[model samples]
Target chain A: MAPPTTPTLAPPDAPPPSTDLADAEPDTGRKRGLTGYLLLLPAAVWLALFFVVPFYSLAATSLYDPSGSDFRGYEMTYAFGNYVDAVQEYWTPLLRALAYGAAATLICLVLGYVLAYAIAFRAGRWKNLMLVLVIAPFFTSFLLRTLSWKLILADDGYVVDTLQFLHLLGDDGRLLATPVAVVAGLAYNFLPFMVLPLYASIDKIDPRLIEASSDLYAHPAVGFLKVTWPLSLPGVVSGTLLTFIPAAGDYINAQLLGSPNQRVIGSVIQSQFTDAGDYPSAAALSMVLMVLIVALVLVYVRRAGTEELL
Target chain B: MSAARPAARGTRPPAGRWLREHLVLVLGLLVLLYTFVPIAVVVLMSFNEGTRNVYAFQSFTLDNWANVCEDQSMCDALWVSIRIGVLATLGATLLGTLAAFALVRHDFRGRSASNLLIFLPMAAPEIVLGSSLLALFVAAGFSGQLGFWTILIAHVMFCLSFVVVTVRSRLAGMDDSLEQAAMDLYATPAQTFWRVTLPLVFPGILGAALLSFSLSFDDFIVTNLNAGTELTFPMYVWGASQRGVPMQVNVIGTVMFVLSIAVVLVGELGSRRRSRALSR
Candidate 1:
């Protein structure tokens, strides 16, 4: 779909180039008509039908009488007690999921920042190749990769053997079936999400600024803090959100790598729906999880001063 | 580059200087290697001989690769995933490309609202998205038909947001001057679009399509919730994990990894060559 353009009309004056496009106004001569709506109609309908409407359904489901089973068919009693029961029963897993997500996000930031910095400022001619390498691991299936982690952290694996040899672990200690493995899996799997955004942000920082800081006798560490770190905040915010949201919702790593003690909110939701057929509680838990994430994201975006993220 | 630095005077120890200079690069390479550790395991295990214990690598054998479809069910699941991935990619890309164009090229009321609508799906977690869709299906009485169509719908729903974001960024970054130039040359709006605008945005569309396919194929959480008895490759792998995982799973993993890397590398090389030609 193209806007009607007159051959004689001059193009609109270009705005000063800025990376942030969210707030930018449409350029002059943009079609101020029905075409936009028409173009957007199909997608809007799909999302409205599938994405937006589902939430309404979920909300209704959440309020269904908890005693109603899926096989017998749930009735919308508007009980609202499902939320109370869900929170009371599954609060531990929900909190544990958030904690694991936060821990993984923190690890990703440290590792992602270093790697992104190197790619942005130091890779030189090898920049593109390194970026490719960063994304290559994701080409593999997620479950397969997490399964590999299971093997890597297996009780009799080399990693545990080394840890035992170094006295880092007792003889009976293991990485698998532990919170550590689950968190590491989350961190590892989501590192690319962290790295790509951080790289995009860090790559745009003018090198001259860093050089000028050094020239002014700022130490390397001090310069990095003052110049590079603040400039990459947008990336950090986006990357951490990208990493944390999926990690928190993820059950695969927890299911495959951890014991029952390490079960997360996602695993509970799945089993509730599929195994227990408790639609109301499952729906309630999902709603709670979404609401919690949305609230956290709002507070986070406001605190980070990246209102454009919304 | 280092020689031009003021601090590169021959006062420091060469060994210490070298280590300090390359430290970040070394560290970055190590982290990159860490990401590949699983792929290495996957590739190695693809050649492993069968054993009751599937965690550790057994003696070297190429039988797994030779009999990649030893488990017929795994292959069936894989085919289902591929078909759904293709169809979902097409659906999401078509719809999302249109939305992206609308958001970028057209001035309209409630534009910010529409933008938020597109953004919400990406931000929402997969479990929530999956469950909500499942709720909708159950509510709509389509729960009995939950299979390929339900899985496809969920995939498209989730992937649509990403496609819109990806394509919108590309469209935003484009130099609109070329389209303006085409218009100045008396090209009709349709002509300008086909000859100038679409060509310029084609790379982004292609990228988004590839991304959509991969996302759809690799999806587990959302698909599993909606996939009533319909197993995809990831679900197969998940189920197998509870029992003993087949070595052939590694074979599929290795193939996907190699194939995608090859696609990416080829794209990179093609772009490099094009740039070289343009410069020349």
Candidate 2:
């Protein structure tokens, strides 16, 4: 909403002026290095207190259930079954999240990668202007942007009207609140994520390499398939992973754009802590999400060569 | 899209070659439109004077913008979010700078561990991370609802890694020699840092700070988890969605969006000027 969500990109600021600090300042015994450590202390303390402590507490909370009516602290029982019961309690939400995430990733890959490629390679002079457009939506509040989908997909909105005209739907328009709408929302919001990284990767790719492929008696399509795709695979991995991970956990679209019944684990977790007042179950649910995401990340890294991007 | 494609990519080749070269280009434009249309629809719809959605514009009015200002709750929530964003940015930037310095310059024990920990919040899904923080806050003996402190703390946690990343990348090129030279001149370490090293990294720090503020202001997930009774802009807009969103939400969103862009522009412009000076 506020920060343009392009992670891994360079900050617009030019490089710093103190480039020669290392070369100029040899580590003299007279000069103290602990000064840097002192500079680091405040942030370290903040992270330790706010970040590290809470995570450990969360991990601990996942193991316990309500002891009595007080519900103030953990019940003495360290039950691992909480995870199983939690998973069973919320399987539908979890599956729906995964499905929505998958659909969104697919759409983003289709649109975002293509856009990135075009802007990076084909739309050379227009790259910055086009990128500004691609990133423009993000400049607005995410909620506002998502709410736009509500307007567009409203039963009486232009989207339905346009689609109906194209005969993509029946006379009645019913795009809003559908799984498709949720997925489309996710893809639209996160597409710049896919596109930006891919643009960086593709832009780094030399056109001469593609020409070389064609020069070697290769079909144009073959050149693209063999040279371009493989070289750009790192971007694909980065972009897809970036899109898929967030889309999977997103409860916002499902809540606002889609039906409540289609709740993801995020919404489920939100209810557990806020509405349901079930900390143990919420903790259990969170652990499952963390595990699944980590496992998937690991598998993707192992199988799909994601480490290359890293 | 068709408007741009034929004009731009049509270096007329054989039909097969033309299609081959432009396939990604054509498909890419269509995809970008598909991605862009939803937000575009909203921005356009905000301009509609009519209440209901329809093909025809009944009239154009400033009623929504007027309504947004009139509503006290939205104003309160927007202010609360802004306060939190500013506070979150300040808190995160201070820590993030230190952390970034440590990660980049030091050969400390557990550096990798520190690095991974620094990035953990960013790496995970926002919900999970938010929930984890909420649980932590709850465990600290706060229950029912967390106040501003909870929201601010959560925002800081979320934005810290970003601050670190932005600052760290800039710090990568810092030559230790300049600091050594300053120390050799009998300047105290703090003086050398403030006058020499600090000025050099100030842009990165400011950029990181502005970036962090914008991100914190826009945050929904972590804030939702920890924000007990306190409502932020995103929280308000989200709640509004259940009932058809008022045009005020659009008004506020457009305003906030423009403001954040302005902030980024300032940061960028400042840096560009610095770069131009250095290059000269």
Per-candidate fnat, comma-separated: 0.71, 0.47
Query: What lDDT tens digits, residue by residue, belong to model 2 across residues A159-260?
Result: 798889999989965887788889888887888778887887888898879867766777767987998888888888888888888889888888778876
DockQ of each candidate, alpha-carbon based: 0.61, 0.37
| Worst lDDT 10-window in candidate 2 chain B | B3-12
Candidate 2 residue lDDT tens string, B124-181: 8888888888878777777666979888888887789889988988777555566666
Please tell me which predicted candidate would have the highest lDDT against the true structure. Answer: 1
For candidate 1, lDDT tens digit of each residue in A111-197? 999999889877887888999999889878999999999899999999999999999999999999999999999999999999999
* Candidate 2 CAPRI level: acceptable
Lowest summed lDDT across 10 adjacent residues in model 2 chain A is found at A1-10
CA shift at A202, candidate 2, in angstroms? 2.0
Candidate 2 residue runs with Cα over 4 Å from true position? A1-33, A66-73, A308-310, B1-36, B50-57, B173-200, B265-280
Give candidate 1 misplaced runs (Cα > 4 Å).
A1-3, A7-29, B1-17
